[model samples]
Target: MELYRSHVLVCAGAGCISSDCQAVKKSLLDSINRLKLDKEVKVVETGCMGPCDQGPVMVVYPEGVFYRRLKPADAVEIAEEHLLKGRVVKHLIYQTPETGSAALTFEQIDFFNKQTRIALRNTGIINPESVEEYIARNGYQALGRVLSKMTPEEVIDLVKKSGLRGRGGAGFPTGLKWEFSARAQGKPKYVVCNADEGDPGAFMDRSILEGDPHSVLEAMAICGYATGAGQGYVYVRAEYPLAVQRLNLAIRKAREYGLLGENIFGTGFGFDVEIRVGAGAFVCGEETALLASIEGRRGEPRPKPPFPAQGGLWGKPTVINNVETWANIPPIILNGADWFAGIGTEKSKGTKVFALAGKVNNTGLVEVPMGTTLREIIFDIGGGIPNGKKFKAAQTGGPSGGCIPAKHLDVPVDYESLTELGAIMGSGGLIIMDEDTCMVDLARFFVEFVQDESCGKCSPCRIGTRRMLEILDRITKGRGRDGDIELLEELGRGIKAGALCGLGQTAPNPVLSTIRHFREEYEAHIYQHRCPAGVCKALTVYVIDEEKCTGCGRCAVVCPAGAVSGVKKQPHHIDPEKCLKCGTCMEKCKFQAIHTL
Candidate 1:
């Protein structure tokens, strides 16, 4: 192996890529070559480094210097000062928000300190395209151990004992799913990896596939070995071009290295993987729907009684798990069931990877142990609500999940606990809402999202969610009636019970959970004829207080509706009839004069 004096690890994840981390990578390579230090230096693009708020991030190994918000121009200075002269770039160092002390390493940052990176172990650390890099991090060691020694039954038994539930929302026992497929009488059984992640703010699957494709590949192969399945398929969305490309590369390399395709590591167990592209339908996330799509049929879900385990792909038994679930498999194999089980809460073992988004200070991907409190995730790790706003609620499980109010902030996030709160741990999308966010509007937003994404396969989900959305829209628009809340609850429950698949069953989650926790907000919108957060336009009326208005003309000049009227240095009055309730006057008012009622 050739030794390099320094290694520059640049984030190439979707977030960083959007922030132009690719330019940073190009600059580093070009600079290194120009400086005639190519032989002595190595530049590698890796996955997300968390802390997306400080993106276009790069880390220098050996010294472990963390640099944030790197511009293409800053690359020369980084190369000249840090790489060549061996002096740290003080200005680029990530500083502690409270103390202002420079955080020298990635682990020192609070964003990464609270995270337990089991599924994301190799991400952001290794060059994913290189098989040798993956090998250096004990990538295929679990597969080698399983194939060389452990029997299929023993593997299944160990996972069952581990208590690792699915990370893909449903929290179903992974080992149990595998066992069903293993026990089923069938020839040429198959394993599938569900990578068609369509959740709004969710990117857990994308990160794993991009950062550590080998993990999923290895785990799927392990699953195939245990279930007597010789063929494997990774059904990924076409939207994830990067993930797809990397997965293709990973599979090709794995096959060439004898890790995939035919006999692997001299075990005589033949296994190969193929990629299936999804048309980006949200319903295809369900196992049965996914199978139909892969089979080149319409992507609609079928009723399960003959669950995929009994009758699946090409009319044979099949084992399917999401990307995050498969990513956890290899680790569970390498580290004993007890070790894996010891990490998380009872009944819900192992860490969960959440895409922390919305009005939080540090928004990015976070993986924490199962029992970690929402308070810790929001206040401690997330750095609390942004702009000094009070934390109102958090929407978990994407559109299919519920909104947990401030009272539930301390709620320990586990599969059972969240479900008890009328929320599922669906795909781990944690969207934090602040005081400025209207609960009614929030509920309406999700209802509209789900209603639009509904496959219309089942009437309960198709019609029920639309009806719920219509009611929510009416409520937000100040057209709600007295019995609207009761109607919503009834409809939500009916949809939950009657929906055919997980999508429809959980479709009313946002409305149901919000009503359960923040029913007063809904009532305030209906009875009081007011939006507490002043977010719903129909319920909000903007007015400039004459006593406080400085007549700076800022509000008048910026108002798109031309509602504000006054001369300079005099109090301005807003014409209510002409006002569109756009909130531009309030936003532009410098004297705190504009108020929304």
Candidate 2:
């Protein structure tokens, strides 16, 4: 075995790859070779580190010195200073958001210290493509334990006792779902991992697949053993090319090692998995629709009576769980059920992985205990709103979720509590909004997303979402009716009650929840004919303050609409009709003179 004195772990997750981590990696390697330190130093490509915004990130082990936001030049300097000379690169270290002080190691950064990583344990810690590294971290130990010592019934009981509800949006009891498939009379049962993570701004599952693909593979084999099946399938979306590639590699590696193929551990039991790539349909995130897509049919949700556990995948009894849900399985098996259950609240157990984005200082992946409050996630973990802006609301659960107002910041983020707030924990996409965000426009944006993604199989989701979207569109365009709010509420309620499948039922969440919390904003849009956040171009006008404006022609020079008119050193006036309300003038002005109303 080749032993290296130091290992450099570079973040090769999708975000970092787009940020040119490849170039940085090459430069680091070149510098290391140039310095004749290639024997002592090793570079390893790993999956996402939670803090994605600071991409092209790398950490030097032994010392664990963290470096962020690196260019090729920065990589070379780190290779020279830190790798060769044993000096830490101070300027490239992550600066604490609260204080401008540098956090040297991953542990020193609050973004990492605050997170409880279960689904993300191996991510950014090891090379995802290397099954050897995964094995070194006790990766397949759970599956081996289950096959050798525990019975199928015992496995189910352990999971049930763990209090692990499905992490795939619907908080269904995973053990109960497995038990249902076990008890159901069928031939050649199946285990399916739902990798169709379609939520906007969600990459939790993708990161897991990219980082620790074997965790998911091992869990599926366990599920197959528990459910009396020999075959499993991973239905991943086509959008995640890297995730799919890693998954295929993991499967191949598992098969080679007899971890996936027949007669594992000489126990006369065998399980294997295959990958099925989806065509990036958001509706496919729903289990029934996902199953349909796996069957090579048009993805559409069917009414439940015969759920997936009873009759799924070519009319055979099958157990299906999403990527995050499956990733939690190995941990529950290795660690005791009580250990898992003890971590979270009574109903919602274990930690949740959230793709934290929008308006926050630390925008990346965050995993915390189930009962962690919004304030803790936003303030302590997320570093609050950017540029000293006040937090207005947080949109959880994607299009199926409702907006949580500032008053609910202290609310414990559990399945029941979020549902109580009209937001379902739909796969952990938390978008923070600052005070400057227009609620009406935000609601409209989400509603439009839902409407566009609707499969149109059901009229309630199809026509009803369209109606609500049209009303929201009119409201944002300064042509809202007196009863538009009431009409939206009515339509939203009707869709929730009448729409088929979970998608349609939860489609009106954004509009309804925004109305429930920010009714005043809606009133301002409808009655006052204005957008309080000045986001709606039709309802907004940019004005220059005479007291602040120096009549610098900077605004006039940049205005594509040519609306600004004034002499030098004089306050400028804007023709509202000619003004595009693009906010380009405000961004261009050296003095903070332009104000939006």
Candidate 3:
């Protein structure tokens, strides 16, 4: 085996890849070869390192020096100065928000250090393409242990004791689901991994698949063994090309090593997996809809009671869990159920992986214990809202989620606590909002998303969500009625009570939750015909403060609507009718002269 003195791990996750981390990697390789440092310095492309905003990022092992926001040119500097000369590149180092100084190691940065990482243990640490690295890190050890020592019933009991609820929106007891599938009378049962992660800002599942494909494969095999199944399928969306590629590779590697296919570990248990790519339908995140898609049907939800555990995938008993939930299984099997259960709250066990986006400083993948508070996630782990802005709200669970206002920042982010706030832990997409955000407009945006994505399977979700969207549209456009707020509440309740599937049922969450918390904002929009945050173009008017206006003509030049009127070195004036309300003037005005009314 070739041993290197220093290991350089570059983030090749989808985010970093889009940022052209490949160019940075090429530069590093060229520099290393030119300097005769290839033998001593090793460069490996891994998956997400959590801090996505800082990509293309790399971490140097031995010293564990973390580098962020790298360019192709910067790679040469890191290779020569940090890799060859044994000197730390201070400028390339990650800057700690608390001290505003360089944090030398990965642990020194609070973004990574504050969270627990069971589901994401192998991510960003090893080369995902190489199954050898995954094996070296005890990747398939859980499957071996379960197959050799434990019975199917014993495995189910262990998971039950672990207190692991499904992380895929519904938080259903995973063990209970397994037990149901096991007990159900069916021939040739199936195990399915729901990789159809359609939440707007979520990449938790995609990252796991790209980073640690084997963990998911191992977990599925374990599920197959427990459920008396011969075949398993991964329902991944077509959008994740990299994740799909890695999954296929991992499946081939597992079969080659006899970890998959017939007679695994010589115990006569047979299991194999296939990839079923989805067409990016958001509703397919629901289990039945996902199963429908896997069977090459139009993805739509069906009424339950004859749930997936009883009849799924060509009318056979099946067990299904999403990517994050499946990733947790192997760890529980290896570490023991009590070990997993002990980490989280009484009802919500283990850590949750959240894709933290929007106004927060640290926007990335954050995995914390289930009971961690929203304040800790936003302020401490997320490094708070950007540019010293006050946190106004957080939108969790994508379009089906509710907005958590500033007052509820201290609420624990467990399943029940979030449900009480009218939010479901729907696949962990947490988008932070700053003080300048308009609550009414935010609600409208989410409602619009859900409305567009509705499969039109049922009238309540199809017609009711459409009604809610129309009302929200009117409210945001300064054309709201007197009883519009009350009507919205009524419609939202009707939809929740009458919608067919989970997606349809939760469709009105954003509107309802925003109304529950920020009723005053809705009143301002409806009664006053004004957006408090000045987000609604029809309700907002741009003006210039003559005292602060330097009149550099920057706003005038950049304005698409040509609303700004001013000469050089003179105070500018804005015609509200001509203004597009794109906020270009405010963004370009260096003197801080623009204000919205």
Candidate 4:
């Protein structure tokens, strides 16, 4: 084996890649080769390191020095100073959000320390494209042990004992779902990994698939073994090309290593997996719709009861589990069910992976135990809201979920708890909000997303969500009626009850949850024709605070519209008629003169 004295691990996740992580990789390699240190130093591209706010991130192994926000030009200095001479790059070190102190180790930062990383176990720690790295980390051991020692029924029983419900938002018991498929009388029973994650701002599954594709592949093979299915399909979205590529590569490598494609540690058990690309439709996230898409049909959902377990995928019994749910199976089998069950709350077991985004200081992926409070995730792990902005609310579960207000910040984030508070754990998309965000506009945003994504198969979802969006649009535009609030509630409830699939059923959640928690905001929009957050443009106007203005002319330079008239070093005046309500003046003013009202 080739051993290097120093290893430079560069982040190659989508976010970092967009931030020119590839250029960082190239520069490090070129510098290493140029410096004659190629034999002693190696550079490898790893998956996400979670602190996406500081992207183009790289970690030096053995020493574990973390460098953040590197430009292409910064790479030579990093290689020459750190990799060549073993001296740290002081300028590139991560700045601690609170104290402004530089942090050397990424794990020591609160953003990484608070995360558990079960599904994302090997991500950022190993080369994802290398099967050898996966094997060294105890990758396919669970499959070998299950095939050689445990029976199919035993595997199912172990998973049942683990108390792991599906992480794809339904919270269905995974073992029970597998058992149902195992017992159902059908030929060609199939296993499907639902990677068509269409939820806006939800990338938990995508990160797992891109970072640790082997885990999902191994877990799916385990599911195939336990359920007596020989064939598997990973229905991933075409939009996630990186995830698809990694998954494809992992499958090929697993086949070469004899870990997949008919067999097992010489145990004669046969199983294999294939990848099916989705057409980027949100409705394909539904189980039946996903199955239909895999079968080369339109991605439309059918009413259940003759559920997927009984009749799925070409009219044969099929077991469908989401990517994250499948990723947890191997660990549950290896660690024993009781150990897994003991970590989370009474009802919801194991950890959840959330795409922590929007108005958060540390915007990235986070995996915490089920019962961890929202306050910990929002404040402690997320480094609180950015720029000292007061926390307003959090939106969980993507378009299919709801907004949780400040009153529920202390609520424990579990399946039942979030549901009791009027939010579902739908694919674990947590978008934080600050005092500047408008709750009514927030509801309208999600409603518009659902309205556009609705398959139009059912009347309640197709027409109801559209009407809801229309009402929210009117309210935000200062054309709301006195009865609009009650109308929204009535319509939201009807959509939830009358919809055909989970997508439609949960489409009204954001509106309902926001109204339930911040009804006063909705009332303000309807009755007073005002947006408390001053975010709704039709109801918002920018004015200069005479006491604070210094007439810097920065606001005048930035305003797309010529709304501000001021001389240098004097108080400014804002022409309300010319102001576009873009808040450009507020952002540009250093004196805190511009106020949105």
Candidate 5:
């Protein structure tokens, strides 16, 4: 082992990679080598650091100097000045968005300070590809202890006592599910990690798999021990190429290290794990559908009763947990169940990781205790809404979730609370909306996504969602009727009650929640024929106020349809028929003369 004076941990997460963290890494290496600092300073490419928006990010250790939104050009200064000369690069440090004050350490950054990392404990902290790094962090200690000291029943009982529910939505008791599979009579049982995370703007599972794959692997092996299973399969989406690569590498390393494969830990206990890549089906997030995809069949859901615990993955009892859920396992085993149970609310224990996107100032991945209120997440942690906009609503659980208005800002976020508000605590996708966002349009967008992704297995989900989407589409297009709201409510309820699987069951949440919270907006679309937020272009008529118009012809030059006409110094006029309602003219108007009716 080489001892280094300084270690530069660069984020190689998918988001950071897309932002050219690879280039940033190369530049750092070149600069470090050029400065003759290669022996003294080491650059480690790690997984996603939580502040994904402000990436490519790096954290220099010993000093813990945090840097964000770095470019290749920035590496020279960091390598030469910070690494070699022992100088803190003040300009490269991470700063709070609201205060614009730089925080030199990870603990100082408010985004991280507010979060309690459970599932994402090792992500961004360790090199996921290296089993040694994983072991250094007490990675497989839980599995080793379980194999050496405890029986399958004890492990299940401890987990059950811990109150760790499934983080993949629906809040199923993790231990109880294991107990069911363990008790069920079967020849060959299986452990499954549902990595087919398809929620829009959600990358929690991908980050974990990319950053701390071994944690998941360790957890799965532990599950295999507890469930009397010798084999495990990770149902990950094919779209996540980086996650796939890292998982494959991790599995190979684990098997080579004897952490996986037969007769593990020299205890005569046999367990192994394999990766099953899904074809990017959103419905496959459903456990049954995921199993079907893994079995090389169409990714369609089957009726549950036999649930996965009773019969899963080829008529055998199975325990399926999502990537996030599995990541929590090793820690629960190592730290003891009580430690894990003490973190969150009574019903929903431990932290929940959310992909915080949309209009929030700090758009990144956040992990907070389950009962943390939305107000804290939105304002204190997320730096409130961006651009001085008021918080209008937030959408949790992606397309299958409902919208939460500002009125419920203080609501404690847990499985039960979210479900009570007409939203499921789905694979934690929290999208914040600002005052300017049109709720109706937002509902329509989610509905469109759900409709397109529906597997079309059952008529209710296949056809009902389409009809609801049509009604929503028509409303957004300025062709809504008075009874449209009632029609939507009827259809939404029907689909929720009749859909074959969870996909169709929760598909109407967005529409239902928007109506429940922002009925006025829906009413405006139908009765007043207007979109109050002016988001629906069809309902908006842009007209220039002659008094305020400067007639610079900026709008005319920019308009693709050539709808605007005016003299050099006179006010401009818009041809209604030719206007595409694209809002290009309004955006270019410098005089603030454009008004939408």
Candidate 6:
């Protein structure tokens, strides 16, 4: 192997790619080559480095210097000054506004320090496209060990002892699910990996597939072995082209190495995995729906009682685990079940990967132990809410989840605790809400999402979500009546209880949780015709506080509507009739002059 003095890892995850990290990578490589340091230095493209908000993110290993929000020119500077001159780029160093200090190592950064990377262990650390790199990091080791040493029943028993549960939102015991398929008495058993991550702010599954596809492939092979399965399918979202490209590559490599095709490790246990890309339907996240989509049927949820384990994927006993859940299998097998079980809460074992987005200072991906408190995740890890804002609530589990209010900030983030607070651990989309977030609007937003995503196979989720959304719409639009709140509660409960699949069952979660937690906000919107967070346009009117206005034309210049009128260096006034309630004036005003009431 050729030894290099420096290995610069550039984030090639979708988030950083969106921020144009590709250009930054090219610029850095070009500059390095021009400086005749191509042999001395190497640039490697890796997946997400956690702190997504700071993208495009790059790190220089050996020194472990983290560079955030880099421009193409900045990469050139690092290649020249930092790489050649052997001096750190102090200006490009990552510094938290809360700490007011720069971090030398990405590991030492608060966003990563508080996280325990299990499923994401190899994500940012290695070149994901290479099977060799994955093998170097102990990938496929568990599959080999299981095939050579453990029996199918023994493997299932080990997983049961590990207390590992499905990480794809629903907290189903993984080993039990495996056993159900193993003993279902079918001709052909199948293992289906759910990579069709459709949550709005969620990219957890996609990152795993992109950065460490082999791990998932290895885990699926293990599942195939344990469950007595010969064939498997990975149901991935078609929107994730990068993940698809990487997964396809990984699958090819695994098959070439004889890990995927047949008789893996020469154990006569034949297994193969194929990628099945979904057409970006949210309801397909349900197991049966995902199976249906994989079988070339409509992406709609099927009623349970014959759950996927008994009759799934062409009427065969199938074990379906999400990307995160499958990724955890190898570690549990290698480390022993007890080791895996000890990391998390008694019931919900192992760590959870959350797409930590919205309103938080450090918006990125986080993997914390099951019992990690919201306080640790939000403040200690996330560096608290940005711009000195107070956290009002957090929405977990995407549109299918509910709100966690300030009172539950100290609560443990396990499945049971979040469920008690009226939230499910639905695929780990944790959206933070600051004081400025309108809870009523938040509820409406999620309700609307669920309403749109509903497959309409069931009446409760289809019509009930629509009714609840209409009520919320009326409340936000200042046409709310006295009985609107009660009607919402009734409709939300009805939907939850009567809906067909988990999609419909959890459709009303956001509305119910927001009402349970921030009922006062709802009451204000309904009874008093006011939005406490000043978000509802119909209930909100932007006014210029004459006492604080300095007659700066900044607001007037920024406002699309000619609402603000002021002379230079004098008090300004806003015409309420002309104000669009867009809050653009307030955002532009240097002085604290704009008030919403």
Q: Which portions of model 1 show Cα errors greater than 4 Å? A: 97-101
Tens digits of per-residue lDDT for model 6 on 359-435?
98888889999999999999999889888889899999999998999888999999999999999999999999999
Query: In each prediction, how many residue pairs overlap at the backbone (N, C-alpha, C within less than 3 A)?
Result: 0, 0, 0, 0, 0, 0
Cα lDDT tens digits, model 4, 421-485, are: 88999988999999999999989998998999999999999999999999999999999998898
lDDT, candidate 1, 1-597, per-residue tens:
789989999999888999999888888888888888889889898987777888899999888888999998788889888888899989998977545688888778888888899999988888889989999898999999999999999999999999988888898898999999999998989999999999998998998899999999999899999999999999999999999999999999999999998889987998999999999999899889999999999888999889998889988999888999998988899989999999889888989999999999888889999999999998878888866789999999999999898988889999989989988899999999999999889889988988998889899999999899899999999999999999999999999999999888999999999999999989999999999899999898887788998879999898888888999999988898999888877876678899988
Q: Poorest 10 consecutive residues of model 2 by lDDT?
A: 380-389
Clashes of 2: 0
RMSD of 3: 1.5
Candidates in order have lDDT scores of: 0.90, 0.93, 0.93, 0.90, 0.91, 0.90
Cα lDDT for residue 445, candidate 3: 83
As a whole number from 0 to 100, the lDDT of residue 385 in candidate 2 is 83
lDDT of 2 by residue, 261-305 (tens): 989989999999999999999999999999999999999999996
Looking at candidate 4, the ten consecutive residues that score lowest on lDDT are 98-107
Number of the top TM-score candidate: 2
Off by over 4 Å in 6: 551-572
What does candidate 3's lDDT look like per residue over 487-569, in tens digits? 99999999999998999999899999999999999999889988889998889989999999988999999999999999899
For model 3, the stretches where C-alpha displacement exceeds 4 angstroms are 550-572
Model 6 RMSD in Å is 1.6
lDDT of 3: 0.93
User: Alpha carbon lDDT of residue 197, candidate 4?
Assistant: 92
TM-score between model 5 and native: 0.97
